[model samples]
Target: MSLAAQDAAKIPEEIEWTWEVRPAHADAKLPNVLLLGDSITRNYFPEVTQDLTGVANVYLMASSTCVGDPRIEHQIAEFATMEGVRFQVVHFNNGMHGWGYSEAQYKAAFPAFMRTVRALTLESSTLIWASTTPVRIDKEVGPTNARVDERNKIALALITSAKISLDDQHALMMEHRDLYKDDIHFNDAGSKIQGDQAAAQIRAALSMNRLPKAQAR
Candidate 1:
């Protein structure tokens, strides 16, 4: 093979992306909430932080990789081990970026992913599972609605079986489809709506966390 061809072949087929946002002064007195997901979460993160300003200290652990990806475990572990931090609620979603994998593969990996996440958190922490947002039909950058629907069904099943709280971001986006800026992402208005919903869920989870064991029971 030619040198250029060999060099091209050396390139990896998969690339892993990760990022985090830790507040400089995360109030120890208030509840800590972790938001985990992909670009959609990144886009709306500011609004979520703002909306939850005094209510809770929100941290973001997001990446372009899917929950099924091994790297995600590392990311979760890193966040879980943050010094003197205990999350009161964790809101997580993953489905948009694993387009290369079939629905079955996605389904098969979900339980393990949830297990890893659960193992890393405090037992008392509320685990809220956010459904993947809607995808518009696009031949390029494709994640057709059909594919998203399939993955969401699998996620719903896993979440239901585990008895986690559902944030239902999918239904919210579907109701405001016109606010989408493209096939995958939302515009400013749409992001605020998503942020509001996320903040609301986080607040509810934190409030529940404060209840007496008997009342919560």
Candidate 2:
């Protein structure tokens, strides 16, 4: 078995799924932007794409794999290899799923996530870390804001140290508790808010080191 398969056998989950979207850009002229995250990222991807429009060609790689899972890096690597496109900006998040893993496990495995993400920094890719959103639902068995806070804190230290831009979705959603579609996911409005903010951040990063239009692929 492969390393990812071996990792999979170590800790099985209730379910596992991955979703990726790479819109065709025949003779594409716009720079590419990649959004990497879970369902929440998937929710906001459309809005980001719409917001970016002619500015950039947006790509999405959202999965249920959490930071603690060894397979997550493999998933990211495989997705990156499959696309074979230079990402001008990569906005990413995790920490919503993989409830089976302990917070300690999450932190322990987070460095590997950073390593995988940093590999995409080729060609001056601007990296932005989207803080995982809050959990509004009070459930007998589900995510909690306390755990979310801990994970964000752990991630923030690394991101800040690395100088990656931050899109604080958790802090944003904290102000709009009513916008949740469910315990974890957001409503259309919340998603729009997140997407618009994400797009604004991406734009700032892109403008910081504006590649000549001639460099677009």
Candidate 3:
């Protein structure tokens, strides 16, 4: 089985090896886009890929690896070597993995993460930074509400100066709390909405001017 397929088969245990295949530029007929995040991106796979159909070629790869995992550094290294390719977009989030981290740790790691992302893609490509989605915190999987909020704050501050655009995922989830299945993840519908929202943010930032239809009332 393909490495991505193997990763898809089991629940993510460690973030150590998310991508075993090195995606080549020739593999993409459209502009290459990568989705880097936790389970939300995993669950929202279809929607995120579907939404970007004509705009770009979207690649989804995420591990449940939280903010502090040494795995992120590896992922960044994999990304850096792909430079000069036709990559045009990258939508990523790390807060769900970050729930366990202290506020100070998250703050310190935020800029380094952004720098890694910046180094990988050219300035011409747009990087979409999705804020950590709101965690219920009332439940048990991980990450208290306080920590989630603090991480989001740190994420906002770090990306602001780095030319990265924010998705405000935290606000979107809070505005629609019914979407989550637990403290740190969302249901299928929630994932789809999240994907659409991220796509919208990208469109807006790039002046792509192509917004998908609004959710039904």
TM-score to true structure, per model: 0.89, 0.90, 0.76
- Return the top candidate by TM-score: 2
lDDT minimum window of 10 residues, candidate 2: 1-10
Best first by TM-score, ranked: 2, 1, 3
List model 2 lDDT by residue over 1-217, tens digit each. Answer: 4444433443546878899998866238877889999999999999999899888889999999888777898899999899888788999999888877777778777878988988865656789999999987655666888888898999999889888889998989999999999889999999999999999999878876585656632
lDDT of 3 by residue, 42-85 (tens): 77656766776676666666766555544576666665564445
Q: Which candidate do you rate higher for lDDT, 1 or 2?
A: 2
Global lDDT of model 1 = 0.81
Clash count per candidate:
0, 1, 2
lDDT of 1 by residue, 49-160 (tens): 9999998888898887675455567667776776447678888889888666567667767888898778756778999998999876644545878888899899999899
Worst 10 residues of 1 by lDDT: 4-13
| RMSD for each of the candidates | 5.7, 4.3, 9.2
TM-score for candidate 1, please give it. Answer: 0.89
Q: How many angstroms is residue 168 displaced in model 2 relative to the true structure, after the best TM-score fit?
A: 0.5
Give the C-alpha miss distance for residue 74 in model 3, angstroms: 1.7
In candidate 1, list every pair of residues with a backbone clash: none
